[model samples]
Target: MRVLLVAYGSRGDVEPMVGFAVQLRALGAEVQMCAPPDFAELLEGVGIPLAPIGQPVRPVVKGVVTGTAPMPAEGLPQRAAALVATTYDAVAAVAEGFDAVVATGLLPAAAGARSVAEKLGILYSFVAYFPTYLPSPHHPPFERPGRPFPPEVTDNRALWELDFETMNVLFGTGLNTHRASIGLPPVDDFRGYVLTGRPWLATDPALSPWPEPADIDVVQTGAWFRPDERPLPADLVAFLEGGPVPVYVGFGSIPVRDSADVARAAIEAVRAHGRRVIVSGGWADLDLIDDQGDCLAVGEVNHHVLFRRVAAVVHHGGAGTTTTAARAGAPQVVVPQMADQPYWAGRVADLGIGAAHDGPTPTFESLVAALETALAPETAARAAALSGMVRTDGATAAAKLLFDAVLTAEPQQ
Candidate 1:
């Protein structure tokens, strides 16, 4: 079978699809990816053919993180329309002869991919990295700018209804316009059309379970993760061997505000607990607080391996980072910035695996307090216990499911 995996957004969004693609190839299926060009190096290293889609994501994300970008409500319709058109063109250009197109990431892009699959009469599936993207009475939908729910409307069902309406309002025109141009029927309900009834939830059930008795019949595939086999840098290895295990701090792809301040607070907090600090200079570009020997700044390394050696993982609780830490049995201090981060943070706290900082910005005192909980012996024990339960074969499972679906649908000779 030939498959096209489409993902658009940040590294967290694209990395899981890479894992799924790798697994599909291992299962003897041909796989290609359509994602932002920011991950070209990552894809090249893994040897997956990439069809670059949309603009580079880093500058856009950096703009949002640093308050230089337009607000979410500013010209959203234009942006949404352009994104849909871009995605459609990118996917349609290379979609011929493919058996399936599995899409995840931003909704607008997914909608475009689905439309192309429809036009080509091929199979299409939408997968979400978190449960919040799926409509469920268990939780309320995320409030969008210029579309806040009424004060009196607290019911989850009602809020979800509002969510659908918002989706239509934001994306319907663009989707239908493109559909018309492509000789396809208009999509009346954008959300329903994009997230079909059986959208796959690619999250670890042990860490982020879909609540029972919910609205949609979600296909809960465990988190799609690719094991990182890159050995730690020589300097990092020396740092680990040089001292007692240090707290590992990094915000992954998030462009954290006041990075120097955050780095200082993290270093001080780790020092307060008598531990060293290994700071990852992700998109935030975090660095050592004061050229101190106790703290080290690094670029991308193997989180799967580094997390295991850390005293604790302090980060901006992205789903990928949180899951990596959980799998490594490393306690966490989750400082949520936006989107699904707070959800992951809450999970960490609820599971007794770590501490959830109250908000995004971490003061010296707050970091110290959160680290106190993360470094606790009980937290470490719980983290270790949970590590044994995290499924590492999510990509393989999802790949087999997709392959089987294709095989079953093929007309018998």
Candidate 2:
């Protein structure tokens, strides 16, 4: 079968799609990918043929991390429109011969993919990295912006109903406008568009055990991981060996306004408790006072390997990083920025495996308190236990399910 995978967003969003492409190819399906231009090297490194998506994602991601972007409720439609325009041409090409098209459940990609699939009568499936897109009475809505709601909000599904209604008003016009231009009928309800088909939930049930009802055919695959496994640098190995297990701190792809302040907070918090640190200078430019101190500021390193050796992890709660931390049996300290981040933070705190800082901007005192809670013995024990029980064949399972869905949708000879 020929398949086209559409994934547009930050590095955190595209990396998992690369893993699914690799697995599908291994399972004998012809697979190609469409993503933002910045991820070309990453796709090439994994040997997947790439079709470029237009608008660059770096500026938007940087803006959000640095506090320049619009709030989620206010700016999502504009972002969605940009992504849809980039996705239209590539998805149109896929419609000619592809058996299936799957997309990351970001609003723009999902909207564009659905349009193309409907126009061509091909199977389209939604892949969610977290359960935020799927609504349930058991948990809060995915993108609850501003201050969090009351503790009793979980018992009220009307909040979800209201959010969905607001979503339709915010996003429906752009989606339907695009659909009409392409000779497709208007999608009356955007919420209906989102929850219509069998959307694949790409998360471990142990980590996000949402009680999805029998009516919704949600595929609960574990976290999808990348194919490459580069060895740690010799200097990093030496740093690891030189002292006690250091706390791993990195906010992958989320740029900060003052990286030095954040790095200093991390370094001071760890050292105050007599521990060492390994700081990942993600998109931000973080420089420590001295290279020879207990803390070492380095560029990107392999999280799969480094997380295993670390005592705990402190990060911005992107879905990919959160899953990696959980898989490595390391406790997490979540300093959320926007969108689904705060949801993951809530999950961590609920599970008793980590502490979530209350504010988007973390102060020294808050970071210190969160780190102390994350390093507790009970948190470590819970993380380790959960890691042992969570399934690891996410890529394989996702590939098989997509292939099956296509075959089933096709008319038999």
Candidate 3:
């Protein structure tokens, strides 16, 4: 079986699909992952074939990357040209050979998925990074500025993140202008205009609050599979052992221009509470100081493995990273910058799993108190219970759901 996995985003986003592709390969499926072209090495390194994309991988690294202000509010054009060059070509090249198309969130490949499915009369499936097109979510809306817009209405906070205006030009005027070029209809909405995969394959249903799982085929895969790895880094090991149960601090790949300010606040709070600090220095740069005894800096370590040893985890609240701590039964301090981050931060607090930190205006005393509360007897017990519940068969459930869909669609050849 040949399968195409289409997805894009930071390491956290692309990494999951890579894992999924590997699993599909183990099942005797030839897996080609369509992600940013720059991601070629990592994807191929993991043994998943690359369907390279044209766009630069969102310069998540800093001054070396994005020319414009590196905000999450990006349009389709910023990446569309690259998608056409890389993802489109990759799909077009293999549209004849692939048996199934599996698309991950917000990628042009969803359109490719539909095109291929129609061409070959094969299966087209979609997996979500967060809730892209599902109905009302169980968790708080990531960008619910207006009472969670209905699916019928487009241009919600999420849709604005895409290039709707240009999309209108292409699907409306352009398609109408050249009807004979390809049989394409005017898109319904820029985002959902693409051929959709099956609905969300989230592992845990408790987190998804959408009633009836939308009309489209939907499966929930809560937490994804945690990859196996070696022991913790030597620095992390020594830091954890020497510290008085440090607070784990890191914002995966967020770039706060004032890294020192955030670090200083975290350090002050840690000292106030008399706890050591482990900063994960994600994509942000924080300079080192000599006086801090309880503070350690490490990067690119697996949160799933590391959060287990920490007293509490502080981060920018990416879904994958937060879940790692959430499932580890550790409390969280979420310092969200933008996008779905604030939503997850709020969810953590509401679920009694963590607290949200307003950047620059942190109430150091109160936050320290919350940190203590997170470690309290009853709070710890509740967090443990939530962790157990979240240990929903992430990868296994997702794989089973995908395989089941494939069998139902194709009857195994």
Which stretch of 10 consecutive residues in model 1 shows the poorest summed lDDT? 404-413
lDDT by residue for model 3 (1-413), tens: 77777776566667777667656766667777777676676776677777665565546445423234543434434444334334545666766777777776544445544554555667776666555345333322333222334466463434443334435433334322322234544444544435343455543444433355444455666656546575888878887887477888777756665677767776777777778788777676654444657778786676777888887887777777777777788888787765667666767777877677654234467567657666666666766778877754566666666677777774211
What does candidate 2 score in Cα RMSD to the true structure?
Answer: 3.0
Please give, for residues 1-413, the per-residue lDDT of candidate 2 as tens digits.
98888887788888888888888999899888888888888888878888877767788778766778745756667756666756877778655788888878466676787778777788877788887677666555654443345556555476677677766766777787787788888776676575555677888788876575633566788878875589988989998999899998888877777788888887788777778988887776656746666887777678888898998898888888888889889899998877778888988898988999896777778888998899999999999987787667898899988777777785111
How does residue 218 of candidate 3 score in lDDT? 56
Overall lDDT per candidate, in order of appearance? 0.90, 0.78, 0.61
lDDT by residue for model 1 (1-413), tens: 99999999889998999889889998899989999999999999998999999789898988877788746785787788889999999999999999999998889999999988988888898999888888999988888767778999999999999999998988889888888998998878899888887888899999999998987778888999986789999999999999898999999989988889998898898999999999889998899868779888899899999999998999999989999999999999999998899999999999999999998999999999999899999999999999999999888889988988788873111
Candidate of highest lDDT = 1
lDDT of 1: 0.90
Better of 1 and 3 by TM-score: 1
Q: Give the TM-score comparing model 3 with the true structure, all chains together.
A: 0.79
